[model samples]
Target: MATLSYAAKDSRTMVRRNLKKALRYPSLTLTVVIMPIMMLLLFNYAFGTALGSGIGPSAAGGGEYIDYLAPGIILMAATSGALTTAISVCVDKTEGIVDRFRTMPISRASFLTGHVVGSVIQTMTSITLVIAVALLVGFRPDATPVEWLAAIGLLALLTLALTWLSAGIGLVAKNVETASNIPMPLTFLPFIGSAIVPPESMPAGLRWFAEYQPFTPIIETLRGLWLGTGIGSSAAIGLAWCVALTVVGYLWARRTFKAGAKR
Candidate 1:
């Protein structure tokens, strides 16, 4: 009982440390917030007319398209923000910070816990900013208060999964550049998924991959919650994926960290 309490307390301390570092630096967090907003603007203004036409006549221009695009762009914000976790973790590993921590009596779990929790908080903040910009640009969700809560909860789960995966990547990466680059695919996976266009619009091979990829179901689930589209099996599948990713990431990160500590 006491051990669990102490671990929790230590994790909170680490979370605060990471959050303070983010506030002091701010550049990475700013990039996380800005990229999604820029993408939202570009797609809504430059291509909204052309692309929205395909979705529906009403969707043409920035009108209905923003509604469709906002969820995906918001998810992208989460993905982009998750990258910071890997970079920060790699920085700590490279700078001998972890080695220093090893000498302390703190809980080993707290280090990774801190990074993942802190990244999730930052990612969600970025998502909130993206959603705000989306609303400003005419992205209207048809969700009730309950649906809004569910959607936010789902987004938080997705962010948690991605942050854990990023933590594992950070532990394994040989350098900060590699750590940063490894998670790049995650940010753009939505482009290939139902995030931007229906998989039915793609060629057979590409569409197959797009539909099966983890992000597609997630985006579909979010779209359903926010826009009242058919969720079908996406909510269940997305939840499964989040759980699976969290388990995989947590195990991998713990194993890698343990291996390093032994050395």
Candidate 2:
């Protein structure tokens, strides 16, 4: 019980420290917030006439496409937040902070927990900001209040999973540059999924991969929740992916942290 209490307290402290860093360096958080909105506007305006037509008539123009596009961009914001976690973790490891902590009597999980919790909170905020901006730009979801809560729940789960995955990537990275590069694929996932264009319009090969990848199911589930199409198996698959990734990420990250303990 004492050990558990120590772990909990340490984790909480780390969470506050990370949040303080985020507040101290507002630019990084600002960048995470702005990137998705920029993507939302750019895609909605610059390509909405051309690409929006492909999604459906409602998506063709007059900002109707923003409705279709909002969920995916919100997911993209989560990806951006994950990248921040990766970079921050890598910096600490590379700068000797992780090593110093290893030499201390700190709770083993606390260091990583701080980062994961902080990133989750930050990502959630970024998602909210993006959604609000999307609303301002005429994005609308027909989901009811309950459905909206459900969608937020899904987003929160995704944020937690991605942050942990990013933490693992950062921990295993050889350097800060490598850490930054490792999580790049996550941000690029929006392009390959149903975000920019529907998967049905893609080539058979690309379509197969897109439909099977973790991001597509998540995006599809989000779309279903927002548009009232029913999440169906997409929600199951998305949740499975989130659970699997969270488990794998936590395992590997815990191993990595304990490996440092042995050093």
User: Which candidate tops TM-score?
Assistant: 1
TM-score of every model? 0.97, 0.95
Q: lDDT per residue, candidate 1, 128-231, as tens digits?
A: 98999999999888889999999899889989989989999998999999999999999998899877767887999999999999988988888888888878
Per-residue alpha-carbon lDDT of candidate 2 for residues 61-139, written as tens digits (9 for 90 to 100) = 3336777788889899988888899989988998999988877988978999999999999999999999999889887
lDDT of the candidates, in the order given: 0.89, 0.86
Clash pairs (backbone) in predicted model 2: none
lDDT of 2: 0.86
The segments of candidate 1 whose C-alpha lies over 4 angstroms from its true place after superposition are 57-63
Instruction: State the displacement of the C-alpha of residue 110, model 2, in Å, after optimal TM-score superposition.
Output: 0.6
Top of the candidates by lDDT: 1
Error of 1 at 130 (Å): 0.4
Q: Least accurate stretch of 10 residues (summed lDDT) in model 2?
A: 54-63
Off by over 4 Å in 2: 58-63
